[model samples]
Target: MEVLGTIISVIGLIVHIIQKVNQSSHGDTNTTYYTDTTYAVVHKFTPQEKLDNMNIDSLNICYKTAGISGFSIEKARRTLLNSYVQHDFYIDDVIIRQNCMYIKVMHAIPFNGGNKCYGASFSMNFMTVNDGVAVYGSKKINADEELVFKEIANELIKAVS
Candidate 1:
């Protein structure tokens, strides 16, 4: 009876230590609060996704946002602007904070009414993480959107590196 009790206690202690290690590794989801907006950011990746550069989940896209080994916010901003202009996208707005930058891009098309316009907008955010950066954005999850994202991300990596 005494031996059985000791074995059970050891197993419990091992389980608790494993749980703690997993918790520390994954950590908590990061929350970003701006003056007018808030976002809950999490990284969800599969093993296969890590091996493929162009493949991403349907809901959203995220990248390590690394340049060489580190990241430079200023260089990222310039690359973003250059891509924005190259793609003929209008700038809705850009907000640069201490550790993050938000860029909104817009595309406008003429409506049937002479004075009215139809437009679509999307936003991309870059935030400093661990030793590099995390770049994430939302999209409609279509082929065209994915292509555009890849183009921009490639440009950013090339420029910063």
Candidate 2:
């Protein structure tokens, strides 16, 4: 069983490496924009020490200010909380600062014939940006883990819109 798990993990790593190479070859375009908008992937790790405790260390952040008019910080916070629950993410903790809300979440994925489960922990922040609200997230996940960056960004955009 242990050998099988290792094999699967190795395969997943290979696939991830291939994908990374392909992405880099194509100029590493990780964001999809709409209309005349700009998206930037900011590699800032605010919760590095904390996230490392949960075995998650990859720093992934996205900033988008398109289609956000009349943005309300409080409304975005509430919407993000609701969206997390509705998306089946287990909320670990939340810290509300002056203009930012920090959230920790975990998602469980059933694996190995549904007997074992793989989980990923995510650390994210929703803050008021100059143009609009911004959603920043970080999670260290392998190929078997679901990537939630896009979902978080989309949810935040929806809230601000």
Ten contiguous residues with the weakest lDDT in model 2: 110-119
Give the number of the best model, judged by TM-score: 2
Superposed by TM-score, candidate 1 places the C-alpha of residue 97 at a distance from the truth, in angstroms, of: 2.8
Q: Candidates' lDDT values, in order?
A: 0.50, 0.52
lDDT of 1 by residue, 13-130 (tens): 9999998888778864563435856777677554334323322232155633663455666666776665544333344444455655554444322211232132232223344345
Candidate no. 1 TM-score: 0.38
Candidate that would win on lDDT: 2
Candidate 2 — which pairs collide?
Answer: none
Candidate 2 per-residue lDDT over residues 1-161, each given as its tens digit? 99999999999999999998988778667666468578787764555454455543343544333545566556766666665443434455554556655556554442223322333333334333444455555543554343444554454455546
Off by over 4 Å in 1: 1-60, 78-92, 107-130
Q: Count clashes in each candidate, considering only residues at least 3 apart in sequence or on different chains.
A: 0, 0
